[model samples]
Target chain A: MKKAVPLYIGTAALCMVGFAYTLYQIFYVAPLAQAPLYYNQKIFYYHVPCAFMLFAAVITCGIASIKYLRKREERWDDVAFAAAEVAVMFGLIVLVTGVLWAKPAWDKWWVWDARLTSALLLWMTMLAYMLVRKYGGAGAERLAAGLGIFAMINIPLVYASTRLWKTNHPSANTVPSLDSSMRAALWLSVLLFTFFFILLLRLRIDAQRAERRLYRCREMALDAGLFE
Target chain B: MDFLQHVKTLAWKDIRVEFRSREIVYTMTFFAGMVVLLFSFAFLRESSAANGGMITDASLSPGFIWVAVLFSGTLGLSRTFDRERETGTMRGLLLSPMPRAAIFLGKAVGIFVMVLVVQAVVLPLVALFFDAPLFDHPLALLCLTLAGTLGFALVGSVFAAMLLKSGSREVLLPVVLYPILVPLFIAAIKGTATMMSGSMSETWFWIRFLLAYDLIFTVAALWTFEHLVIE
Candidate 1:
């Protein structure tokens, strides 16, 4: 715990630095957008990074959930819970930013395109995971673990199924075709978001750890007749 | 050999229990019928008003039919598991000398059949009410519904069992199942819509997707039930 403090602060400091630099590059270095989307297109840099991080968060939650289900360990559940909450934050940003970008780019506030719908459904499942964890009562942990795994498995299927709607959102490889300056800015933004993601995950895991420890203390105190 | 027989017997037990009262089937079909009726009430007039008679858009029937299938599917799934939890029979069934996967498979098979039975009423009703041609490719339609129903049942049975002991099972069941089953619903609806449009190749594509969904989730549900369930 003591050693982790410095690493946490260092990551936070590095992330701040990265964000400051990336924002400068995005605003100043990255060239003006093309005809249709001149100014608002900058949202793509933020939106794409958040979208990528959301995927990372979900996959992390799923892996941690598998471990928790297999071992029934408190630590694994903590990791899974932390990852899920982080996923929700990132997922929200992805959807909102994507929608904001869409209004200017696609001339629609929302599109029923494959990528958008899949992201929407995936975010909803993550929201359900949070709901079940909060309200599922006694066996909430097990139920949540099942949901986390199921959510991960549905990722590919959801994307594939919604593709039938004839997608208009930028394709997956659109990132590669961007101008060199904009692409560099986007990469820097992604790096900054990665740092931020790690900081949030670590903080949440620590909070969950503290919570379970307090719970154990209360149970032990009750057993010892200290409270009664 | 032994496993299949065990699964069959367990499924048979469920069917017999269901046949005795027929409460689940009757109410489920009725609920589905109401959904179909409501669809007609809501959209039939809109379409009729648009063109002044039954020039009902065929592309739209698939969405209505699937809504009914999914809604009634959730209604019956929780009730089916509630029956087990009410009498503590799930525990007994778990305790008996049979594989855990068998119980899961048997229960899924039972619900799969029930949802299919409900869909039987739903399809013709949607067609009759909406005046949409959903039966042009009979074989494709059959395969699509079967595959879609199979995916729905496999996922629904596991979730219904997971939420069995929870207090908010009624609300939580659909809250949990609908999002997870979105892919299945999309594929099924797409398949039906394509069939209505007389597109065999695309309809088969969606059917294949649904079949793959069933295969993956069937394994996932069995694994999850075995590990997640406790007496």
Candidate 2:
């Protein structure tokens, strides 16, 4: 655990640089472009990579869920629960950035377009998973694991709804073609956000594990009549 | 042979119990009916244009109907799972040799059947109250309704199974379910709206969308159901 600290710090440093580059692209080069429409579209570099990180976290939950179900190990459940909480935070970041972008680009604070609504769905699903963990009691680990699995099941439907329906929401076809410089910057943002997501997930899991350890110690002490 | 028998027995047991009480169906129907009534009063003030496609001003008819079903569907989902949890019978079923997905499917099928009946009544009630003339494209309406209901029940069962033993099962299920079901709601509403507005030509397009949605969610629900119910 002591040695692991350095890895996390390194990852954080890398992510901070990526975040800086993402901000630069969105605020700088994006504005210098010939068209104003592309101005807000630059938010996509930050917005989409954050969305991908959220997907990665959710998929991690699914994997942890399967492991928990197969093995009934408390450790797997800890990872699943922790990953889910962080996923929700990243999801909110995505929602906020998208809203910021939408407000300037589309002249509306929000739109029921498929992608936006889908992100909302994912947010709610993550929130529900966290709530189940928080309020559902001792038996909740199994249940939370189950809900994680079910919620992940909804992701693709959320992603594909726009292409399937002819709605006011802009379709994927509307995504602007990216120049070479923009493409390079966007990929770097994705790579950097991925590192940040991993670092946060590890820190959360450590916190959860420590809490569980303390809980078990208290339980065992009570069983031995230590307090009495 | 044993697994088949187990599946049949569990499904039949749920049906028999539901028959004895009718609690789930009654609550879902009344709630669904009342929602349509409330929306009609608030949104349409009078029944003058109720005979035609009148409330076409806003995204009225399908929007209101889908909202009602989504809410009531959650109500139905919790009732089904709470029944198993309260009685402690679900553990016995889980310990049985029957596949877990079978148990999930049993619940899914039961909820779908009950909600379908509710929608059957609710759709006509909307047509009569809002005067939207829904029956003109009965086939398309039926397809969208079935797809939407199945997706709801399928995903809902996975959730119910997930939440059955937990304390906040009732509140937890819908909070998780509604957001996920948005696509289904949109597809069903759009497809149904087109059908009702007599846009029969383009109706095929939206119907396919609903069908695709139904297929995607059904498979996802199936893959995940085992993990949810196995414990």
lDDT for A17 in candidate 2 is 74
- The pairs that clash in candidate 1 are none
Each model's TM-score, in the order given? 0.97, 0.86
Q: What is the TM-score of chain A alone in each candidate?
A: 0.97, 0.88
lDDT of 2 by residue, A182-202 (tens): 776777788888778888889
Clashing pairs in 2: B50-B131
lDDT of 1 by residue, B91-199 (tens): 9999999998999889989998899899999999878777788777778989998999989989998898889888888998898899999999989888888888887
C-alpha lDDT values of all predictions: 0.89, 0.77
TM-score of 1: 0.97
TM-score of 2: 0.86
lDDT of 2 by residue, B1-231 (tens): 765676577667777888899988888889999998788768754324547443433347888788888888888888877888778888987887778767777778888888887898888888776667778777877877887888888778877787776676677777766777777777778777777778876667767766776676667666666655534
